[model samples]
Target: MITVDEIKRMLPHRYPMLLVDRVTELVPGERASGLKAVTCNEPWYEGMPDTATEEDYHYPWTVLIESWCHVAGVLVTWDRPNPDVRSGKAMLLGGIADAEFHRPVVPGDVVEHHVRLARQVGETYVFEGESLVGKETALTIGRLTMTMRPASDLTAPPVPDPL
Candidate 1:
């Protein structure tokens, strides 16, 4: 088991963005399971209109996906110190596929993400997972890919005109 403080060390996310609260299970380079508590105090809830409909009040799907990715991040980096913190490298979201949101997540919900390593190529890792609220699945990710590289490489030079 890993505490929130330890998870903070493994992931670059913080405050409202740090979705994973604790890791209950981890198998280095294999799989991981983590939890996140959804609360009305989150930044996303700020300025929400009092008259907003149920659809408008749903938790952002992107953040839910990111929470799952954070769990996968722990699984991928389990064998080494966090590259984002230790070496100033950046861990990035490369791609996501077949991501389906099944139910709306409310403020009082506790999301549990279960992730498995699907593949790895060089510094890129692919994961398959699902996010659940109790026994009900909230979302299913068919494939999610992440890549780690020097932060300096993130800047784009320029695009030339087609000849």
Candidate 2:
């Protein structure tokens, strides 16, 4: 199991943005399974009014996908750890497709994300998986791609297009 502190070292994400709680299973460069528990005390829930219902506390899809991707990041960085994305190489999302949300994930729902490497081409890796809450699958990822590129390259001035 990869603890939160260990995950912090493998991933650049932090509080509020760091949604992955713990990784229960990991096979470097192959596959991984992680968990994230949604609580009512999260920052997003702070803005909820007293009149809010259960649906009002539903977890955001963006956060869900990001948390799952963090697990994928761990698999990618297990051997070559890059704690800082500002330098070294950074993992960037190339694509995410066919994300089917089966049901709403609400507060108290512990999401179990199962992700595996679908393919690897050069510095890019494709992942496909699904997330579940107990027996119900919440989201099915048809394909998710991540590419590693130097941070400097990303921030460097773009080349001018000569017409």
Candidate 3:
């Protein structure tokens, strides 16, 4: 069982951008299952057309793709005991294979991401992931090919105040 705090240690994502809320199953070198509790307060919800009136907005295609990638990364990155230098770093999207969206996902939905390791070719780890909302499969298929990168690439340096 992986808690939100434990997930923080495994991946560099945080706050608004961090997607996975919990991890129910983590089988090293095989698969992983994660949960994302989507809510109306999510930053993306504000820009959605139907969100202003409290109606469920059609989830953006890009965000759905990103979410799939994030979960895939988590599956691969957490496959082994994390290395010291790898902590706080992120898995960069090296490529994608067979990515296809099946249905729409809306707000107030609990998205469950299931990822399986497809193969590791050279420096890239390939993962196939799917997102489900309740009994409906919102997204049927996608693959994330990723390589690890420094945390600095994902974070901005602190700006100093005027003296």
State which candidate has the highest lDDT: 2
Clashing pairs in 3: none
Compute the lDDT for candidate 3. 0.69
What's the distance in Å from true for residue 23, model 3?
1.0
- Candidate ordering by lDDT (highest first): 2, 1, 3
lDDT of 2 at 131: 94
Leading candidate by TM-score? 2
Model 2 score (lDDT):
0.85
Model 3 Cα lDDT, one tens digit per residue, 1-163 = 7887777666666667677788888788788888877766778776656435533566766777677666666676664433343454556666665677767777778888888887776446767778888887777555666766555655653222111
> In each prediction, how many residue pairs overlap at the backbone (N, C-alpha, C within less than 3 A)?
0, 0, 0
Q: Per-residue lDDT tens digits of candidate 1, residues 1-163?
A: 8988887777776776788888999987788999999988889989988998877768899989988888988887666657364466567887788999998898889999999988887788888989999999999999887887666777852222111
lDDT of 3 at 161: 17
lDDT-best of 2 and 3: 2
1 versus 2: better lDDT goes to: 2
Error of 1 at 56 (Å): 2.6
Worst 10-residue lDDT window for candidate 1 reads 154-163
lDDT, candidate 1, residue 2? 94
